[model samples]
Target: MTVRTTARWALLGALALVVTACGGTSGSGGAAAASERQVQVSATFAQGGGGPAYTYDTALVPAGATVEVTSAAADGGTTTTLRVSGLQPNRTYGAHAHTKPCTPAAGADAGPHYQFRPDPVSPSVDPAFANPQNEIWLDVTTDASGAGEATSTVPWTFPPDRRAASVVLHEKATATHAGHAGTAGARPACVTVGF
Candidate 1:
């Protein structure tokens, strides 16, 4: 064969080797491994139309405060974890998945908590429907340095019609009282998350 033919053969051989080195795109009949979906949102507390919106006190959700929500589903169950940073130190804050996106106007714009079962009310006050088992309650108490994490694993996934849209940070831990069950005082900041 000519030198040109030999070079063409060599190039073809190298291509084959490269293809072998990299795993083929097609699967091997078995179900492909599931991939974890992570949604990251940065929180901000700024003065609203009235005044400082995020916090009732002088404390502010420090700059660079962020919320990270990660979800993985397998074996007929799903686990969701949320981590937050740069909040008020040594304070517990009520957090929940909301149904609306975070806008600059006010925390109210973020809408209500993303309840798995439709509460049939704007703000769910009943403990039966507003408990952590039914809602995403990621209430966290910051350390001295202002960081915390919470996790919730459920047998079901989020609502298909309306997924979690944002995470709202409240000023207090959620309550369990009747007709006041999911009350977390004063939403100071909201982080827009996509799931």
Candidate 2:
């Protein structure tokens, strides 16, 4: 081949390699894997505050405590992680994604859990919709240093328009029983996360 023809072939080969490394543009699921969707938020808890984070009961979730949340979606699934510091030591706390943002007025303002399938009944005590597989449950246990982390992965992703708005930290671990499913103790702290 002539010099120009050989260079053209080399350039084409280079372009092909670039496309392959970038997962190609064929609208295939491979590209989706390469482009995992993720959202992260970090905030410090405060008492009587107006912010992305609030602590209704400063004893469990003390003022100045920090929380970092990460939500990632890929392969028809979603994983949520919660990390907290400066909380009460040697304690287990329950956390779940909520449908509304955290408000300073009340921890309950965060709304209900972000269920994969909505429950017809109010306060959804049914185990069908309140289970960890259907909801994001991140129960964390703090160490002596008052730091903890918990991660939860579900088999499905959130609908684009119906995503969770916040994560509420409860006073105790989640309960798993009919008539009391998904019930944790009082929500002491809440962190607003866009996921």
Q: Which runs in model 2 stand beyond 4 Å of their true positions?
A: 1-35
Model 1 lDDT per residue over 1-195, tens place: 699999999999999887766545433222445333444544444444322224323365654465566666555555667677777788898888788877766777889888777788767999888988888888888888888888877666754566877777888999989889999988877766775
| Candidate No. with top TM-score | 2
Error of 2 at 51 (Å): 1.8
Which tens-of-lDDT digit does each residue in 1-195 have in candidate 2? 699999999999999899886665565675776557899999999977667999999989989999999999987999999999999999999999999999998889999999989998989989999999999999999999999999999999988789899999999999999999999989999999999
Give the TM-score of each candidate: 0.72, 0.84
RMSD of each: 5.6, 3.7
lDDT of each: 0.71, 0.92
Best candidate per lDDT, number? 2
Which pairs of residues collide in candidate 1? Answer: 54-188
